[model samples]
Target: MSRLAVSVCLAALVLAAGPAFAQTATPQTPNIGGFPDSPAIPAPTNATYPGVIRYEVDATDLDRHIVSVRQVIPVTGSRITLLYPKYIYGNHADTGPIQLIAGLTVMANGQSVDWRRDAVDPYAFHIDIPAGATELEVSFQWLTQSDNSNWRVVMTQRMLNLQWEKALLYPAGYVSTGITFAPSIRLPEGWQYGVSLETTSFENGLATFAPTDLYTLADSPMFAGLHYRRVEIDPEGDDVYINMVADEAANLAATDEQIGYYENLITQADRLFGSRHFDRYDFLLGLTNQMGGIGLEHHRSSENTHAPTFFTSWAASAGSRALLPHEYVHSWNGKFMRPADELTPNYNVPTENSLLWVYEGQTEYWGDVLSARTGLHTKAQALVLLADRAAFYQNQPGRRWRNLQDVNNHNLLGYRVPGQWTSWMRGTGDYYDEAALIWLDVDTLIREQSGDRRSLDDFARTFFSPEGTDGDWSPRGYTFDDVVAALNTVEPYDWSTFLRTRLDADGPDATAPLDGIERGGYRLTYVEEPNADEKAVSRNWGSDFRWSLGFSLAGPNNRIAAIQWDGPIYRAGIGAGWDLIAVGDRVASAEVLREAVTAAKGGSDPIRLILRNGQRIRTVELAYHDGLRYLRLERIEGTRDRIGDILTARRR
Candidate 1:
């Protein structure tokens, strides 16, 4: 037989035997159990460390963004484990960057010793001490972020924000409060700095601080710049200083009226809490566009950064004034009276966030209220901002699936990751704004139930500042039950059920809690013109047509920034990131788009849009007929204005 005929015969035989092959037994799969984990590093205990840690950081290498460290740690045992910080306090996750440490060397008696990283925990390093070796010298370089690829660059040509936890490691056996550090830093020439730490001495460019516990050292970050100014906002009381740094000298210019606002902020906070937590406080304000932005909270200080022209352009920057108030409120809410789970022994332990809705949410509510009370934002602006928030939660689609309680875990799942479908996914920080709305509900309910004689302010004073601890800043832990007890003490009601109904409700039937708006004597209504706060925000964030066309435009080139889920444009198969090419017959501009939407209202015509999605070009006809809808708060007749009274400044 020929070779071709032989091949055809083989194929025919295989096809004829296919059924028999299919009837063969299935192959058995291998199964294996996981290998046992290495023994855990020593758990932290309350015993005090025998000796202090001598730590030094040389951040003078600004051009390369390298932070060099040399730490001398005293040792008593033969085997010791060192742990890199994993759970940053404000971040609410195990997000410390262990990958940034390079050129690590451990030395004993001037001889390099071998070290091994724990297989299960990469943040831990194990080393054996040689006989008669009293201390171990460790050196490493922290490669600070130099570009904008992932994180914000902390080091710039003219300024730097030094977070101490990023530079040093701690022994594993003792709690963070038991380990002490005499920390020092060397900065660039002619640069002044601001920190919450008490400076013991300064020589040349190096500054040395008093010996402090590991927990406090990490919390006291430094903001240094060539142009710096310090002003005492509360000189009559526990010294509260606004330590400001800027890239340019002119950016530090604060008019007398602008300075008055900050002074009013201190007074307003004092009256609201009716107690002091810290002996001294510092507002570390960075007025620079170059440094990595931060708004983190600490017990006695806060890290805040704004536009370089924050003082120079006060009126134009009104929308951003609430940042200081928000972070400052954390002193009473989060830093002092903290959640029990968040009061971890050390930085490596993970934290639970069941009460973040109260920690971050109520602070957000009080932040805006304090902003209004201190004249950071006008009373009219405050109402408009409230209206905007009301409309947002009312239109949000994520509530159909995720409730407020479950959303607290989002910090660990995906913190700060942007989403194309953000409205449905509900990003991590929604607790800030959404919880604010819930607290508003609580505030209004309290006032109504008490016949206007009591409010959330009473709850804050009684709960945050208990009896006989007037000037204490010690950490006081609380549980969910404690929160309920405090609320009931302020106003007698089923506080637990009230909070759970709003926190645990989900599915297709769930809706926003807007009873607060109604009870506060305002009703959320749509208008043809944008409110003042919205217009000011739109100047930089682009136009918002969320209610009219169910989409908004932002960023460069008028691209679709956000599209409402299952709304007009979404139902029409148009999505975000589509660049607007034209609106009807005119070039695509905010004005042109508004005109097109208005023209289509009450008419048979569809809103025509020419959009370029990637390389594909297509024309979409939106069936939306609503014309330029914007949200505003209207006063309800014959009802008390509870919201106004809530925001009104309290007399000392």
Candidate 2:
């Protein structure tokens, strides 16, 4: 029925029944319904945009940390909309910093054209084209972050990282791949830069890149610095370059042995995946303490940052060495073979992350495996790292309510916020580590079911690197059913039930899935001292008392860095961010706290701690005493060492 006819009939029926129904109840306060939702911004379509967008950025203003931008967008309609990039791909969130764009102006045909932001979608700007106007001139300034307190400090005194999405706007109503962009940039004179885009021309400090689709342009970022060096790590196969940039020249000193480890990384990855995706890969490494750390993955390249002494002080930077391998594996897992829901056509569309357990989880597993295979960490260090991860999930209390599958949505819910109640609320990116353990379970299960003939390596080759479709970096989306089918292809079994039990189970009985550790012929054990990996990475980060006193203290003030969810410290009513004033009678120090913990062990005495929370000072007594516990993995006797076997170099 038509809307008017249906409404008339419904109103008549309501009046007919009102007299009878009203006699039984008293009149209630009237409630007003909400207005209809504002009209949706234009949905993206496959139609191509009319003309290429011209985008240029002047990033030489280091002192002010500003990126001046000019974009010329061709138009075909009288009224058009432009959208700032949101729902960024790598970040998997609506994290576009639109507030940073300032002083935006649009002009057409030598006259200013008025523009208004959409009332519903603030990321969109609507403007009317003047009569006979062929294009619109848009200008804005992107205020780059100056401090590392919350956001990345992209522009430092000696270098800058230019992400295109932060500096340009795109036309709505078309897919990102259907729009083209000719991007160019101007850097300070004498600064060298590295990017994935093919440079067409360079004059003075300006460089113009070849025209590319908006998708690729947004994915490619530039790293310019006072000191730059590009070295080819994979010369035997496809060219893979590591573009190293640093605040000072001496920080670029990468020894030959250290570089060889990276070369072995490529060789090991080739053996695992059995195919290459990108034609050429670029590893953009920024060795700096000036810029905030990043480990974002891209289709053809990855953006990464580490300490300035990452190479010069090799052993000290062991914790960060896995970053490169992790991002490198994403080219095959996240970028090429992607989850169907996460493969959106444009940046504005929301992504469903149900399959992130496989997308990011397996990548996390392989990153660490490859790191060990390439000698980035010794086998002992690798085992220690594994024990640390296993122990973390064992102590995680949030799993009682939040399952592994639900943790996948954490990128959207919390982004990067590390809540004070970590073990209960769950920290950001728990899927990365917890899912890695689940994959380990899957790997060990496959080995056991197939009688050692097949493992996840076979599944990776069958699912991600399918034959006759290699050397192609184009995305291929897959569903959850596809994952099960591929696993069945490797070894026919009830894969669905296995994955669901680990992914969906909850309540108090839902401990972390440790079948993988036992099946891999290893057991998680505790020791009085931490292993090599923990000791190496704890240089600046303070003491670890997680296994003993249930909290950790850091910084010179002895403030609690983290507290276990249901541990002794939590039961004693102590929360994170409280500064320790003294332990018993002695003034608080890391050593003094450890001595107290050790002395209280095997005795009936309680540990006394004086703490300051804000302006209030109180003495709290901890009724538990466990002395300095640390995690370690011990090999089970007379069983196959599948984890050790997996860590063995496949190429070697």
Candidate 3:
């Protein structure tokens, strides 16, 4: 439905239900838009009154970027507190998916109900029920996002992803798990959908799902499209399914060899962990040029999206091939074993997320490792990735002021800050990439300390799969002390100091990379031409030599991204926001910058740069010279081939 049509529907409801004056007016300003204080009530209530919710989604308006949602919530009291959940799981902020919802109204007993927003808990809306009302029907319009411009996407005539939490409301004061839901969706006439939710029946373009709890209901998202293909990636019938939907039929055709890599992935993961958490799993993928890309993890499935040509142009998309593998590993690391502070019973309550270094960072470490083990990317590609990450952080000027721990704490806001002068102007979170390097050090330290009898793989199976639970895929929360205690079980060390020192280090300290790389029997070096990994990354997004030069070159005119704090360029007083007019006395183009660096040949002679920063034109010379260098992994050849041991795939 078009925006006009949505408005028409909303206006019709207003006219039919009651006059505009009937709405219960909100008298006060909202304070921070969520429950301000911790709840005085205890969790789960010990008494399980099964709360139920149902949604009828109309996707006929997908072309107009609209989803008509009619929701019904059963209430058991004269006064009910209805909450549009904030602080949703997965996203570590109290501001959840509330922004995506529009055109909302609650009605009961054929009368327009009056609702008031709670001043303290802004996400909570207080609605008064009629004397004999059994249920309240809430209707709204959801705009499918096309971009961040209006925060909407009309993916394609073919594909759509449904995030249920953004559409429904529930009774307040109860755990999300304590409530039950029966979700029914109506898609486009010929469109098919994939979800972990079991099917009850499908008729007249409507598909109703088997009843489940709120936690499980929200955990299972749906991917639907006109073009669909389902492949059983594992012979073990209930193990895994790869459901791929695309914009076109040709984009959906994947070769057997290409699919075999993922099959091998399932086998390798099972052997490494020695257990399964969920009864079944799904990899829900959406391939479309019409929609913005996505990668969100759930306990039983992952919502993955990429370019329409993610498979056809494998070499070009090789950089993102590990996206599937990364989210898959989360089923073990994040979904199974979360940080204790982050494991809240409901989304409305604020969650403490200081331990993302272990939760997301260690998961990042295993993600890179598993990508190599599963043949999603070659072992050489893995080395290049780590080197790229280390080199990337080494050039990040923000590390001087902030530490890795702070990055985790401020991730929600830090992620969107642009890279115009990233190294200097802002301190972005480095938990994922930088934390991968940190966890790699932890792995190497374990290997070196234990004389190869144990590795991080043991840490994985031990920490992720706790004994006695016997494959139950429930949230097993842990604290920092639990992490340190687990590390002690692997190999005793002063882990507290070891981690704190690394986290507190200021700016471009190369010790962790140098020590970790050497310990793994390899060293970081550079080459003239870009490697396969570098070429792929640079092709997608521009590349630079920030590791050595302290600033990245981007844009069509080769503009400065940021100056590394006291880096080769920063020392020369050339900074970010400066546009390069010429390099080597030639007009600066994409290739001109590279030719200038390559011509210098590590010579002391300064490479001249003509920079224009808002009408101030100046000629500057970069004093230090290192020819165009790309990061590569080189074997130390003598000590021990621990790098090889780490990359080897596990066998049954």
Candidate 4:
């Protein structure tokens, strides 16, 4: 084998037999490959690497829902420390996906070999090689989904979204970027593939990608299916492509107007971040409810998995359209100009998410803005999304105990928290929503300080737009000081203190956030009837985000997931996980609860609630008389509505 891909282990199915060939040799104390303490396996050098970790991914087992990966590694050592990827780049809940890797085995000289796992690192393996072996190969089956878990590689009869790290192993010593890789895939016959990768060849059912470093290779994922279509969204040689793979060809058929909106999306994004970091960009979309459902950002592309009707049922998926723009914006913000610590050399390094408030938060801010600016979302639709997100943070009781910084760092445990009493006890993704509010304040402040001469657009162009695009996918890191410096360059002020005060707060002070909303030319108020965005979100969760009543329910059953701290429900001694037994004479479904709230809208009538907390049942009278108080971003009379201007502003 060449000495590039895997510094692999080799064995001849030969054994140094002693009394070890006994029956007990395998069962209880199975043979594990290792090397002598002296003259340890020679450290693989940078110069000797063959420049590509070649992978031949076979998806023929799609019907069986398994993907077989065969890897060839160039090695010189008698042993290689190989590990499945761990600690996903931006996920705090990293372990949830790593376990999906199954049936991993290493081989040498076409013979099965024994490999030992490092006791300390669950993902690391120490493989043994027979003397004189120059290369190693491994074949493994990665199960698409676990028995009953949603966390798995998405592989269906129609398409597949390959998260490379989960399916391949790499040598441990070198930085992932320093090592090179060339990947090729053999799809089930007639299936076409779309990826941001530079393709070297494409022939019947097989595609080869240009050689890339380990980091870039892993970052470049592919979406392939029997039914696929690529729509050019930009006229500049179609630098932007909407690569869609759906369960059926009908889903691939999108209206011209719908497709036109994406073209504007590309235009607005180009206007926001002055320079393009990628040579080519793809919005790799999977319109399949069969599997994958989140948008992950990459340098040249975004993995956008949404409901099957992402195009056809656009209105119903109102708020979700933001996912695409959000991940796309990350190519400039989170992927290009990242926080220094987050720009790790390899995939295994734990991410320091303390700045996610900026990484994800700012992206969330622009995601909403750009989505609206591109006409994917109406201004009202954007406001609904912002208000919903804002109300979530304002009502989050955990924010009182944990500041935004701590909330940002909560991903250290991979976002795994007990469900009981989660509302007040735990913080979920506040950085995305809450940070959006904070950054909105920053944008408004920029306009205010600059006498409306500049806005956050100036900030983005200043920080992200380089003189030229390096055409490299690897991230260029930044620091907190770098962020403050950039803001200062736009308009001089105590940005350090300004951002620190907002992010470091540990109290439920609505003054700053409310003021920020007002600055956006709207006041945060409530109205009757949940908007389409709210109702759409409610229908999915089976409950309403009744910021007025202060609780989110588990749905048609009206069981509470959480109650806002210091809110009326909390004051009434209500807690999470309790069943809303009844509202006066009616059994408490979300409808009854809303009706009860509506009935008490005009007067100081007390709504009597019968709640069941485990074995105890109690009656509580909540004197909340604000009519169906759904949060809204209503116009502040005669105030400046710069939101529209902010959405369209660009450097001329």
Worst 10 residues of 3 by lDDT: 33-42
lDDT tens string, model 4, 1-652? 2221112322212233445564345433222433332123223344435445678888778778888898888877667887677776656545535565677777777688887766445667778787776678877877777222656448888888887777888887777767877788888888887898888898887888888787787777888898899989985566899899998888887899999888888888878877788889988899887865767898888888877777787667776778888998999888888988787756676678778888998998998888888888877677777777766665566756667778777767545444555556555557887788888898988898888998888899778876666465457888889999999999999999988987887765522354577787887776677666666643443356357677777755678666677778888877766888898999878778777888897798798889887888899998898766667778878878877667663434
Name the runs in model 1 displaced over 4 angstroms. Answer: 1-39, 531-534, 537-542
Model 3 gets an lDDT of 0.76
Model 3 clash pairs are 1-61, 87-94, 144-153, 145-152, 145-153, 146-152, 146-153
| Residue 633 in model 3: lDDT | 75
TM-score of 4: 0.87
Cα lDDT, all candidates = 0.86, 0.86, 0.76, 0.75
Q: What's the C-alpha lDDT at position 349 in model 2?
A: 90
Please give, for residues 1-652, the per-residue lDDT of candidate 1 as tens digits.
3334545565556556767774674433321221133335899999998899999999899999999999999999788889999998988878788899999999999999877787558888888888888999999999988776777688888888888998889999889999999999999999999999999998898999999999999988988888999888883565898889998999999888888888999999989998888888889999988887889999989999999999998777877899999999999999999888899999988888888888899999999999999999888888877887888888989889999899888888855677887678886767888889889999999999999999999999988888887789888898889999999999999989999999897899999988999999999889887655767744543378877787887766778767888878888888766988899888898778988888888888899999898899889998877677888889999999999998899997
Q: Which 10 consecutive residues of model 1 have the lowest summed lDDT?
A: 27-36
Question: Would you give me the overall lDDT of model 1?
Answer: 0.86
